[model samples]
Target chain A: MQLLNNRSAQLRAPGKRVSRARVAVVRAAKTADGPRVAIVGVTGAVGQEFLTVLKERNFPYSDLKLLASARSAGQKQEFEGHTYTVQELTENSFKDVDIALFSAGGSISKKFGPVAVKDGAIVVDNSSAYRMTEGVPLVIPEVNPEAMSHIKVGKGGAIIANPNCSTIIALMAVTPLHRLATVKRMCVSTYQAASGAGAAAMEELRQQTRDVLDGKPAQPKIFPLQYAFNLFSHNSGMDVELGYNEEEMKLVKETRKIWSFPSVRITATCVRVPVMRAHAESINLEFENDISEAAALEALAAFPGVSIINDRQNNRFPTPLDATTKDNVFVGRVRRDISRDDNKGLDLFVCGDQIKKGAALNAVQIAELLLK
Target chain B: MQLLNNRSAQLRAPGKRVSRARVAVVRAAKTADGPRVAIVGVTGAVGQEFLTVLKERNFPYSDLKLLASARSAGQKQEFEGHTYTVQELTENSFKDVDIALFSAGGSISKKFGPVAVKDGAIVVDNSSAYRMTEGVPLVIPEVNPEAMSHIKVGKGGAIIANPNCSTIIALMAVTPLHRLATVKRMCVSTYQAASGAGAAAMEELRQQTRDVLDGKPAQPKIFPLQYAFNLFSHNSGMDVELGYNEEEMKLVKETRKIWSFPSVRITATCVRVPVMRAHAESINLEFENDISEAAALEALAAFPGVSIINDRQNNRFPTPLDATTKDNVFVGRVRRDISRDDNKGLDLFVCGDQIKKGAALNAVQIAELLLK
Candidate 1:
């Protein structure tokens, strides 16, 4: 274990360090002709969600290992109706695993992910840890599957990153249209669900709701403030220069990266809503060229993994309730953004289950690519 | 009644004719010199809210008349322990009333309001009726107190229109700042409460919430769609030019008009939330010159009727729960609008009880001016 930690430290340097132990592990897994899987921080919110996705999607796996902090070790969880005991993640946790899913905090992923990869397991990290790493692929399977090709096999396994939850929900609606028309700028306001904050936050929302309903004082624990029937700016501390929070900046950076549009400008206001599951976004886009409402609708309708729910005549549109528990991103309230130049702009309302398409589902889709 | 309707038709345009025969009867109780007041639509949501505001503010009045639709007529309501029976509105009902508070639907106001005014009573209308009329003052007491001067005296009674619920809440936060710096443009998305749709709509939200909790089917009647744990675009029909629904467009127009900034460009997305009381708005504004966040916060803090709840360090920002049943508009999450130039931009999260400041409170405040 100490030897593995030493090798991981070497890999953490800016320039890559070749690790013989990682290469050996990958070679052994490859020779066995069966995929080995490990889940890092398997007791966290996204970690638990990833487990559900793997079982529901029926990911091809011969061996599955659940790893978490020493504090959560020895806990039993049921995946695919099979109880699996969590093991304390150590330097050698990924010795025989072929694919590792990391949903722990960024700091943990930053310190341990490279070590796991060096020990031969491909990492699909659901954190900001290596998302901006120059050589790493930040993959949203529906939008950028090609990025997955960069994953290395035996020589220090490749690391794939997932975009932030809010970014994924917003881009899911616009990426298809951007492919049709060059999206120049976008203004978005996100109504994010409590679950996006993690499991404890969701529990806080439920408790606060119960408290408020029962005429008891709401004592918020997980969130910085009460989450009962309230909305607030994303929890990022104030930014002096742009007034954009850390979450908003993540949306801007991740969307640009995922869409491969470096020059496209994005501004976002991420809000925490009282909702428990899905996230809703109100987006206004300015395109380079004219895109008629009909044309935009048709383009969106044809996009994979995107569903158009606009029916102004019947007063129907995509809402969190409609998108909850669904894998597909729902887009609606599509109209030409009359506030912008004629025919060159559009306004849309989008909703998607943050835990699904925004997190676990996207991770599962990436794992599916491994089979192909 | 036919004669009264005919007379009202001659004074107004064809489409602006007030309905006939409906009047609010006021039983005068002698007092030294105070005016006699009557509240129409007294049994509905806004009307019930008006009762609270009137009693809390203690607006001087010698007599109070409570009027409702014929279906609710004769129902007894107590205010400060004085029981008042709701009387059906008729053409001659306003004979001795000095001020009438009108909060019925637009059609009801359009039909009967003129008769109230014709019968020598000043009406502070909570409906959209006569809002755009040339001589009518659309008042928000805080924004345009001088507009109340246009209220007629005795014979030809003046009608003061209250702005839309969403508009009043948004403007309450922006109006004070717009006074200091020139507001060039604004983008707003409203999370409006079900009470804004009236009594039945609020009941529907409660029922839907119950149904959702019990795993029963949610049948939406007041709204065109389900209101349980969901949000939707303002259900007003799509216009021919692909502009926003009437509700969305009304926020834009009313804000500009109330601020007396007709040229200020504004875009709005009005969404209906399952919330029962307060309406929350995510507002982004672009100013004419550089407006530092410090300066914006200072301006808002000093502004009357606008409370600053922006303690980001403690996450003590405003929410619907914080603003519910409160008169002041709760403004927080104050930051710079990163999408625009820093010096000339600000983003704000504001919440206010839509039934109160948005409708009933504003109307009562205007009526207070009539008393003076």
Candidate 2:
């Protein structure tokens, strides 16, 4: 697999299309036939990216079905050089479907996930509906593909949960190190982007920015507070007693489920920044065993789907724009934590496209694993 | 002092001038006499802010002199309803000056600081030049006024250093809690603003953002990387050997000096965000003694130059816009650290104006202490 860190500059170019052959690692061919695929929430930010990622990875699908709510039904979407009208999603929509990608929302996933699974589709859910379910395999394909190894295409119906965006992005960089030195505690502070809410949130940011620049008052519609040239705490519901927002708790709870390490302590502070697409995180990790900076960087460089940009001489580290629309999670500022007296702590800064690796691509990767 | 958290909404209002009488805590008036004051780097961001803050706080000045580099020497600046020409900063610029506020840069402070002191001018240097210098008191008036008790107007000449902006903002919230429970370890991640770099960087952000909105490429000038809708690690010089930038190290080293406790373990990841003028930080602390959320909030509320906006019910915490051009450091998301099972850990989000409290207001407050 090619180390895609050098392509980071090209990825930031506006309207530039990336070639999948150069970006995605070629998977071993299993059967000569591809599965029938269905994408739930075909009009959402993550749902739209699912098509792009599938087309980019050259995922073979015998029949592609675009599913959305009634409001978005009949919408025309172009995918793989073909235009398809989105169909209203229902229980009977998953007939003979081999793979189903769900990203509408947690409520929709909760109502329709089992319905689609009962119809014999291997449902790869992007929502939080089944993520913490005991039997559901919450997976980041690069980190833990074996969790869902029992399920395969054309087999009995199964639901594989994709971890939350913050969890996926953080684990993309931390899991490699966790394997080297057991992670004892993790502290993550996220600079999240506008796209995590939905496509409308991204549009709202663009429109609000224009209004603020023109000296017009920013109308807060999608968000409760002004978001133009400004940022706020994540709008997720908060556990008022615990003082932790749902977004922060998601990182804590989701990581424990994905890593299957319930004993590892984790805390996070998630805030929404005005950036368009990608999310950035400042992660501090404490390890059970001593790990040096050189050894950590060596392991990160060798990890698949991980790109490093630790250029201290130039002071160039990962930025959100560097990871916008990119496949790999960009990691930098890899250093031993000076706060710790021993080499048991490390600090890192990571950036990844929240809509891609955080949601769509991770779900698609799980779908790829099922094909095996 | 009246709690100003209620005025946070008005603070975010565009083009609204904050009335100082409603903002600043009333200090005791010494003598009828006022000091002869000079502002070094009067044309820069913090330099301009020093003029506003001085006027707002009603700092008594017998005569106000503006000093900058030769290029900005002839520029006229209006203050307190009078216009003054900026003079070229030199050894003779401080003649008969009782108080000199310096914000030009490190090199300018290094050279003119001693000159001003030799001329019997109390120099409040707002640079990193002498922050860690032994015997040179680094003060945040509310946090450590006693550090400069020996220096006074008309008594003798001395140079007092102001801590870094990130350090000042973080400590404004943390110091109060530290007083309650001794901090054994502190981890800070900053969402800094462009104003910290200087006025030019702020202008660059404005211009670049406009260009990007117009679909043109962002032309990076003040910063090497794209600054519009993007963030990067602090552009301060890096210590390649230690893998820490000079900005991050300043927080670690300056905190120990200000608190007069060198044993506290501190680590920081400083990143510049797209915000215009204010900085926000996510701070996690481990204390030697146990502290609760209610106890932490009580200490913070009682602390001067700090305001609490921890409304967990509304998920309305402090944003950078809430602290822009405000005197008080706005704090929110005050909660017990769920990462630790014990009550010894706490988490806080802090925001402060980089040019005001982080730079000018802090320097003026130190000058206020000197007035006594």
Candidate 3:
């Protein structure tokens, strides 16, 4: 499988259409009827990342359908050397598809997710639509694959929800430690990238930064605040009564659901930074039982899709650029909290591409588990 | 006093130098015999900010001395219609000085701060050199002017230390609430700006961002990592045994000294963001006594040099740019922490200019108290 990690890979011209021999590989698998794949919201950022992740993972697929809003219909997109015209997403779009990857916003997912499931196409939803819906499974494959084990691509269709990007990125690093220490409370402060707000926000950052650098005023269209070299609270709607924004609450709520620990206490401050791709979080955790730093490091090192970059002597912990376009969630600055006398408190920093593992790749991994 | 808020104020090309008639304001009465002033490390970011702040606040000075390292010694600086040649700093430089504003790095401050005091100059040091030193008062003028009341201009010389930037900014908003509710524990995560590192680091952020936008590799010179479109753990030397960096520990240690509360439990994680001149911090406080959100807001609004910008309905909160050259520390996202059911935990976000309110303006305010 070819791993695509940057703009160069995304913009690389197709090296001729896939040869007949390459297509034959799909014929050897039981699920290789490639569960006719359909990507809802194919014109969006995570929509684009879904295709990249699918191609990179070499997921067996036969026919592919690109679906988006009516406005984006008929747009030409090249995937794996084949040019496909986007079809406007509708109730009937998933009729014969065996698997569907939905990256449209929550309303679109809430409306179409069930429609797609009714058509027998297992849905791996990237939005938060059915995530907390009773009996609907929210899965981060590396963290909780068993959550959706009953749903198989060929046998039946069901909507498997993806956790929030920050939640997914954070749990990827902290869950391993949790398994060992039994985390009692968690506090997180996020340095989120502009991409988490979508492609337009990312472009706004680029344009605004360009203007700021050229000694011009920053005209913030996507965000109401200056975003070129400044940051603010997450733009999500605030729960005025609770004083927590939707993003912060998502981190708190989603972690509990994904970990199946309803009693866990969590607090988060989500702020939008001007970084282009990955998100970085500073997390401090209190455990029910004392866990040494070495034990936590050992656990994190063994966790799948979790990479450790804790270099203390050189002071090189994870940075967003190090995790940009990368698959693994990079964890660093791992150490015990000095404020706690008990060995139960620990702190760490995490960075992961919000588009990849946080959104697209996690949903794609869920699709893979459906095949298994 | 006129307050300058942006580059138009800082970068305004010098008009014709002021006439001799305009210079007589320094000859006015009171503290206007305006103790002769010496600005140490005048070529650096905070040092230059000291000059602007003094000019903006109408800080009275009879004669101004600009001092820097030998490399910057010959530079010409125009201040209040007078052009003064930068003088290479030496022990003898403070002989005629009544008040010295020091923003040179710690080593220089340690080496020269005492010398300036011995030479009968009251030194308002902006480095971390003597902040925690015994009998050397660490002050935030609004919060702890009493700590420096003993030192008066023209009476005797003394070294008064300015607290660390992050510590000063955090305490500006939190201390007011602490007075009302008695904070028991504080957990802070800072999004520090490039200017905290100095003028060269700010230039690096600009240059590297341009390079990254042009598809060129970010050439990291001032910072070891690519700071453009990214964030990293604070670069201060890490205490390997405690796993806390110098920046984080300074927040813990300095809070104790400035608040004069020895037993308060505090922890901090400091990360450097891409913003140019201001630092933003997300702070969570657990109080010993319950404090209502309205009460906290009331306290903050009534505090000097603390402004509230939390408009929950408009989703408008403080950003780094909003506080860039502003004297006030902007506080927002003020609310009770939902994760804590006890009404004792409150969360807020703060932004203050790293060079202005955090360092230079703070030092100048301390100097003002010295005059009183």
Candidate 4:
């Protein structure tokens, strides 16, 4: 795990230049008898977290290939007691890799993901790319582990997409209850963490906090304005009509795909907060069938990978602080949505570490599925 | 002026017990020419804000009386350059007073407010006590100025109630749009500041922030848990039927009352943020008729007390950092709510200094109606 521990290693190349000799050397070093893993855009935030997850989970890997853009070539990353050199991601980067974990931007995935699949590597993409594709499976291991079995790797390696971070956190709580009662409509507002924006944005929030506390002028380079002590609409570009940002749209679409409910009307307001990790969602759900708050709580408590933190009497429930650095999604503040008809609606507050359940952990879990 | 500066003076007595000689002293203090103002429960958070509002607005007063529970009696508070000792609040506290401002807990207002009215003082209550009362006018000056005209003196002096902080901030922006186009439904998620809870809660947040940043043990006092760098559902208690908490219910009820829309459906999720002053709301609204995003922006720009800050191209919008210390509510990220029917739905992000427009400023505005 030397690579995961070495935080100062330069993860990106100073310029865009690919070395054919390096790619050849790295390809020759890989072993076919052992687990072969390819990390696409390994310099990004989720990509870095993926490295940690693989190490922490003790994934059986004999050889790992670090892949990024041409500009990231020659950068070094260490994992599992071995230091791996980064290779410029090309059309054939996944030629002999057993598993390819993609967290590069959606556009990059859109352009290079299929090429990796054609190279006979199972692709677990952590971007919006291929998520809504008709045949592609968007999976949350806890919610849809069975979907991973449908992966076809003979003709073309299968691409498994991860759900949106906000959607994954919300659905981890809502899905269990939906099984007890069909969720008809849901309203969710996300208090998303800064890390969701990637490494540079996280650094910006950290620097801003330091500047504001020290009475120095704080310049927001990644965000539009000050985010040190404020909340704002999700930063994704605004949609033409519904005024929802691309982030909010991702939640709406991803939840439907994961839950297999294309007609379920989900309205979301995704807000970016100053918190460093974990995202919280305030949710109100309407069900087709009547359900009591107690019953909903029972269902949530029984669900896997979901913890019931709703103890209002003791003033205990989920908060972003409680969810950070943990893998489980926390659900609390269970009550009936009084504004709805009778007991047909329920209100819940949910929080989860976005870097874990929302990204790296899910991707790593999908890789484990390939081994099984 | 002495009273204004020494706003936290202790009340005079500890219980409801008042000597006849003390009553005589109170009677003799009333002047013939000066307007009489009664401060109900002059010991709480909103009660303190009312004192500042009076001083800042320089409300003309010949005499002032501070009234609170017997437990808080003998406490002194200064207003407008005069130090006034707290008197035991009773059914007779409003005798001969021209106007009374109530911010005590609801139970106290329910018991003493009607009695104050019977004694011939118009009451502007800051509690939930009279808000939903049949004849009680729930007022936000910018949204419903005419509601003040309904407050008449000596006809069992009518009681006017201030809307909830979240409701007031939302309506300040929504009222302008509703007037231009009929609003059918609203989905609001609030990121409320800790100050909305009161002075002690604000202090708790500050301490928690220091503790977290300094690597000290953080403790939760005013809140159920640590308040630094985290978010939680605003209401901790659950409802019997609809899992909505009392705070969420207030947003729904108060919005309908302020907008005078009995049939409009509103779903709200209120969460407490670590921020100190301004409260931010992510709103999704549907109109009866199709409305273009451009038209809505034009209407919002021309609307009074509303400022548009949406500049997605530059990543600028309303945030608590920008809203704090400001009087008017700031609205931005205005666009159509694409999650709903095309142009029929709109999404908006709004922020306002909760302690100002949400409380003190609105109270002062209501007091201005008294002069008119």
Model 1: per-residue Cα lDDT over A94-193, one tens digit each = 8887788888888988988989878877888888888878878888887898977756445458788988888888888898778878898787888888
Worst 10 residues of 4 chain B by lDDT: B2-11
Q: Is candidate 3 or candidate 4 better by lDDT?
A: 3
Model 1 pairs whose backbones collide: A22-A118, B19-B111, B21-B91, B22-B89, B22-B90, B23-B89, B23-B90, B24-B93, B290-B343, B291-B343
Worst 10-residue stretch by lDDT in candidate 1 chain A?
A: A1-10
Per-residue lDDT tens digits for candidate 2, residues B314-368, read 8899999899989999999998999999999999999999999999999998888
Better of 1 and 3 by lDDT: 3
Off by over 4 Å in 2: A1-32, B1-32
Kindly give the stretch of ten consecutive residues in candidate 3 chain A with the minimal lDDT sum: A1-10
Taking all chains together, each candidate's TM-score versus the true structure is: 0.88, 0.92, 0.94, 0.81
- In order, candidate lDDTs are 0.78, 0.88, 0.87, 0.78
Expressed as tens digits, the lDDT of each residue in B1-372 for candidate 3 is 111122124334577444554444323311436788889999999988998888777787666788999899889886655456788998788888899999999999999998998888999999999999999999998998888888888887899999999999999999999999998989889999999999999999999999999999999998899999999999999898878899999999999999899889888899999999999999989999999999999999999999999888888899998999999999998988877779899989999999999999999999888877
Highest lDDT against the true fold, candidate: 2
| Docking band of candidate 2 | medium
Model 3 spans with C-alpha error above 4 angstroms: A1-32, B1-32
Query: Considering TM-score, which of the candidate structures 2 and 3 is the better prediction for this target?
Result: 3
Error of 2 at B184 (Å): 0.3
Q: Judge candidate 4 at residue A362 and give its lDDT.
A: 85
Candidate 1: where are CA atoms >4 Å away? A1-34, A236-242, B1-31, B214-219, B237-243
